[model samples]
Target chain A: MNVLLPQPYLLFLGETTEPGYAKTAFGLRDWSPQRCLGEFSLPGATVSTGLPFLTPVQARNAGARAMVIGVANAGGFIPQTWIGALLEAMQAGLDLVGGMHARLRDIPVLRDAAMQYGRRLIDVREPPAKIPVASGRRRTGRRLLTVGTDCALGKKYTALALARAFQAHGEAATFRATGQTGILIAGGGIPMDAVVADFAAGAAELLTPDADPTHWDVIEGQGSLLHPAYAGVSLALLHGSQPDVFVVCHEPGRDRVLGHPDFAVPDVLDVIDLTIRLGSRTSPHIRCAGVSLNTAKMDTGAALRLFDRESERLGMPVGDPMRGGKAFERLVKACLA
Target chain B: MNVLLPQPYLLFLGETTEPGYAKTAFGLRDWSPQRCLGEFSLPGATVSTGLPFLTPVQARNAGARAMVIGVANAGGFIPQTWIGALLEAMQAGLDLVGGMHARLRDIPVLRDAAMQYGRRLIDVREPPAKIPVASGRRRTGRRLLTVGTDCALGKKYTALALARAFQAHGEAATFRATGQTGILIAGGGIPMDAVVADFAAGAAELLTPDADPTHWDVIEGQGSLLHPAYAGVSLALLHGSQPDVFVVCHEPGRDRVLGHPDFAVPDVLDVIDLTIRLGSRTSPHIRCAGVSLNTAKMDTGAALRLFDRESERLGMPVGDPMRGGKAFERLVKACLA
Candidate 1:
């Protein structure tokens, strides 16, 4: 009588594949099936069809009683001290814990293994990151938007030109449930109301259901709010709905430095302080409020004068959420200067 | 007393998430508890948490075996025929089917339910279309060569530049051994000499059991010969090394007017033309020898001047296959004239 059962979750493969476990750890755009249960294999190991080879001891024996891996990719870009050492090795859940030493001073072996693994770390706490706000009232205040470039690039023309850059700022930008209310939605929070029906149902369109609108403060997160499920949905929307201004969008050709093998040379001020540590991973009342770019591959006036001189050295508006909100609210108070 | 053992070959995600499984027909790929095995109730999907919202009989009453449906736009590229009609309707021996009378020519009401479901019809055994060969190469002597692609974009950089383009056309290629050759060896098959040792592990880097040189002639297939176990190891090296000349290497991009969503595009030219429409597939002193092209995303001098003016409108010289062997014996007497 021995039962246990729970495994099947080792994840990884970022940069488009997620039809949420598209048939065992992603494959079938190029077809690689033999066996998979909760996959993360990333064709880094065989599959053109020499069936299920896996091995990191078969990904610690077929990953899934949980593991998520994919630290983006230095090629596509990763640092913030490699996502704070993979969120301090997933909150140091043992393997001798230790993490978050800030931008890891140019990796001195992950800064001496975060000073002997921050004494077997653990405080899996995380809260403070707000900024979702528009939860209702906007018929006169005005807001509507969408943005993209991951999950097969350009999130539906950056979320329908971010609802026509909030109905070109005269006000009331609409799309679903008319006078709309709020719904930001990126590659995130989509229980579908279009972001192309939540990226063609990957992860089964995130469990499918969303009328949103308690006047609509939807916003959304994931493709990388310093990631780890965009820091677990910005600390579950700052312990549930405190948002006000966060916008981040981006593509000064993947934040400067190129000839791309996916942007290798990064550091235009460490990718504009990794786009303001993705709004300082939520909670300084969460104020980043501006960046938007995906000009297909730049030159929109030299990517808005090098993203308006790096949103004027991050203080933050480089603007054009498909153009409006009065020049994206003067590029969000010149990026909240 | 519960003995239902045969529920093991599973798959499912949508026949409206299957419950008393009787309706919704197929086209699958959503579900991932490590490629599933039994018991059912999946819905955590992601790209920012999706799927989970079941209803279509509360996702077939959250229980037992098969389903995976999810695909919405793969033209702009890659959805793989809605994941082979939902893993042939969630796996059990298979049947899903195909399309055309010209893709139901403007969906005339699903072309009368595909002529009353002529066995679910998939564009009738695809990616194979061209045949007529018999041109040169056989002085009744030489043997094995295999090279590939006549279409499926860069099959491992044209099978390691057709093993250094068959040792710069003097023959002798090598890199043999196949063993689960999928995504370079993570236990998948990364030793064809460390897949050409670099160039991003191309011809499975010459199938290395290690230490090279054994007078060439081995070759093996790549992009795991569109995998039904490397297309039965490329149909047992095209029927036990009768080789002589299989070089193809495809993807000269567009001109087959619309339809290359690549699962090796109808997977390796529709299951390696069951040995080129049987005559026990080639080597009747083999000839359709050369084709190469991997000029990475075509325009190889405008696809060799549109295949030398369509090999002079089919009077042969099947377009500059490096031109001669008497213009491929006048393009094999204008392909069986």
Candidate 2:
């Protein structure tokens, strides 16, 4: 499907030139990226902060739609602000596509987990439409929550906590709709066989199915390429509930959240904005919540630094800081304002 | 495990004692008329219906506990209330379990589409704690919904919908915790395999392992039974959101709502009043949302008439009326007031 990327997109097209990325590419049906340079035009902003010299400059020079990637290993999770900056940059209307290592074998944890879950790991030549309901009514003023990292790195808890926080704030927040939950419904009841079947379903259904868990059965968005449920649920709940804002909590998988670290965490800031950019339009009042990697040997201040740096990087205000609960909460109010 | 029954309680004694009732005892187990002779001396107000003939004295004299058991038919799906008059005559508590042969065999159509789904013959055995978390809460001055019925009738939906309606009405309710939502947190998550794998080592973060659609996994409530996640989510929301008023909804099932007609339906009023009966001290103030059957039928007027007849037979004031909406709602408000 033609993924409608938001303007001013900044995405890295990593070893995508390789066979792995191309094999999964939709448009590259019979052909690969090598056969089509500048043959396709970006619908929006595309930024690449990871590859500094060779890839970014080359793609830009070749008029293949590009922006440079950046990073730093400062925060625990990727910084949310950095992604915001990239999104702001994209508003100038760029085409953004995410790129990374082509071979699954190259990524250890990713490979095994993908196999265990029975999902695919593709280059996503043409990103799937995360926002399935593309309508004026569908996108505006809808409640949105970005959850579950591509790698199950504790995103679930973060999503639940934030959902609670939202309810605390009187906003109806739920665990972002998930694929498994949909499958559970399709499979006739929660996964009772799940080792912690009871616990998982309990957590999800605790607040009344719709109240506790966002509807992801038919919507799409908010997950890696493999599990389409993430995207589907996102679309469904957003269509159904239609809240006023969107908040994302993240722990960048690599150093990308801050923009210059050697590691490869998806920046919380960029990812959140990329969500709307890659899939759907969030209410302008849309707010993002960041859960930084505060402990992983990075400076405690690394998360905050990513904010300031990304502000300079992506071009949005140092989106209000949520220090622990205080800053995070204030940011929500700010978004509402 | 010892099934706890009140002392001095009435139960069916022997087949010889009640010639017609003799052949009716379930092969699995049945209370004897001899055993029924002694009431389980439960401390509190006697289960009086103000009808002298309904007195426990005569019931005890008959060497039967003031117990009521509905007659069964070889056919299928009997409404427990069919024996209303018989129950009122003895002013006894009855335990009658029944199932649907035809309906159970039919497949469920969602959004009303058939063929895409396959139906299986379903038979459920009635087990104790059917309406598991029926009454009693840690708090007071708050309204409580007292669910009265054997298992698999309308308890779950009654609890959930009543709880939901209360929340809708700005009342803080919990199915698991006694509150506005009248929703119960029984049967935690299904404890499916998919859920176990997902949480454990991020096996795709899938929720539960698969199960055959035709058969149930039938385990005695494992996975966070003591501390349910459903209750956890709802309670947390209540704690954070703090609603007003609590009205419990009670749904009657096949054996109860559509129970065998041979026996007179129990005083519908009393069956709905079960939570209060059990919670004698607070019986006067508890709010009951006499439930509409989900897995049974959806006739508000009919269900209400059935309940009203039971109440009148037992000599209680006739209820306003049964309704899917406003009619039942009026009674709910009056009870709390």
Candidate 3:
């Protein structure tokens, strides 16, 4: 399925707002924003942060057919002050898509303007109307998960890399994004953590719904087995995905669980063992497929050495996925072979 | 706090319907009929279910201050045909409470009738307004969880028993239910399973909200660790409760995971270990404090013998909670001490 918007002129709204959407803005820029004609900000912007800033008319002149509210604010709320600018863009005949908690469609003024102008106002964060409670069915297919030793430690990056590797190997594979960053990258996904706890797995199950039997669903994991604040989300994902195999994602030489010093990150073997057993508690077929190390902290040589050493220890595939190593690719081939 | 209704004068509506709310009806009767004036049915009922059947006026005459719509229908829908009788009850000054998928308060006709009579209409299955994402805080004071091998294997009963046992010992303990049956018994609780998945744990956390450090919270678990159809609920509950200790509730001699025969019940030790580790993944202070065996399948002697053997194996107190055994009480004491 075509998940991302087709090749079309785009305008990013508020790329330079106070308390900037650094994450969303950086993601859009990385996704190649030359495709975006320019960005729109308020009147008095002192510095250009690389990307060109424009007004509504200028954006329309640049052939911008769509406007993306490119900021994820605290609680996903869009300030009322941005409404006038958004309305002006809508009046300029550009459809709008936003990932805000306060739905643009719920605002009568903007919704009415969109209706009047025959423009679409899409809220990316709108939840599915219905999600069946997960059955933990051990469904057929090579479903792989990227679990982590800690949160923000390369689970999403590993999943994306592996999806690319699997596709290159002439296999049917899909990257199932479960977080905001991955969702932004993949173009469409239920922000798993943003979802209500009961539906976290349901969302995962929905995202990875019964595909072709030969297809591999590389689900992006969230939180960590050891994260004090957010482990429930991980547990739900683990159970919901019911993956046949999983890849452990970890940043080498991490002293403690991310954001919490009280919880120490355990050995890679402990993480693997914990993940495999937890994943299999309901669906007994689940196993740890391999390990993906995020060795960004180490030099390339040290990272490679650590990968080789961990590979010997795990006996399964292991590698720095970002560096395009052989270990994770081998793990995928071994599972699908 | 008063969990059950105070000196309830209840009228059971539709006691003899084709799709009988036999479970609910039986539960209410078991809770005691002296508490219920009688039941109401259509005029010509074939057989009596012991509780005297009454019409609207007859129910009011029997001192029925509240009318309970008693059919736990397939979809929990109160049929349109039953609405007239319910309106009649409401008009007769009887407050209404129902456990149904469709909220009676949301039904305009019933809502209007309740308003006309100045009576309270309650939908027991309604979820909490907002449940914050669980932070997995290792809070002080003891929190005990009742996790079962399968659904309907007496997780609720074990929790209730433990709460009473703790209260009898002059300790402050509360029974927090996560299902309809438990809510009916508790008078108030967010139905965790029925809640939107995102809010399941939040609901649990809300129910057992941070209380006085000296209070023990006995949380009634839902679903089971092994049940494929509903393990997500179990996992969410495990993380949401963040219990200092947990009690394993299992029905001895059961070969399968309740309804799904394909999934066999695993060893008690496996369940205990998995529950403890999963619960503490985020909050490391949690542990398995004891085991409560639903030994209804065996005589007291056999049950005690099995408990003793299992207790010795696990090195924890184990017993049949219903039979008033010492193991469960001792387990509570050990955890709280």
Candidate with best TM-score: 3
Candidate 3 structure quality by residue, lDDT tens digits, B106-133: 8888878877889887777766666665
- Model 1 ranges off by over 4 Å: A1-327, A330-337, B1-161, B164-337
| Worst 10 contiguous positions by lDDT, candidate 1 chain B | B193-202
List the lowest-lDDT window of 10 residues for candidate 2 chain A: A183-192
For model 1, how does the per-residue alpha-carbon lDDT over B1-337 read when each residue is reduced to its tens digit?
1011111112323212323221111111111233223222234322211334432233334442223222112231123333443433323322222221133123344344435533232322122222111111112333334434422343343343344444555555443433212111111222221111011121221222222233344344432222211221232234333444444444455333122222223222332342343212224545443344344455556766655654454333433333333443443233222
lDDT of 3 by residue, A35-142 (tens): 566767666543233677777677778777777777665767777778888888888878887766788888889989998999888765655567665655556666
lDDT of each: 0.31, 0.30, 0.72
In what order do the candidates fall by TM-score, top score first? 3, 1, 2
What lDDT score is found at residue A92 in candidate 3? 84
**Each candidate's TM vs. the true structure?**
0.25, 0.23, 0.84
Choose 2 or 3, whichever is better by lDDT.
3
- The superposed Cα distance between candidate 3 and the true structure at residue B126, in angstroms, equals 2.7
| Candidate 1, A1-337: lDDT as tens digits | 1111122323333233334322222321111121123333433323222224333334444442323332223243334333443344333331211112222234455445546654222111111122121111112221222222221233233334544444454333323210011111111122221111101112111221233332222233323212211111222222222233445555554542222122233333433343333222222233445556555566466655665676677655656555443445675443323
Candidate whose lDDT is highest: 3
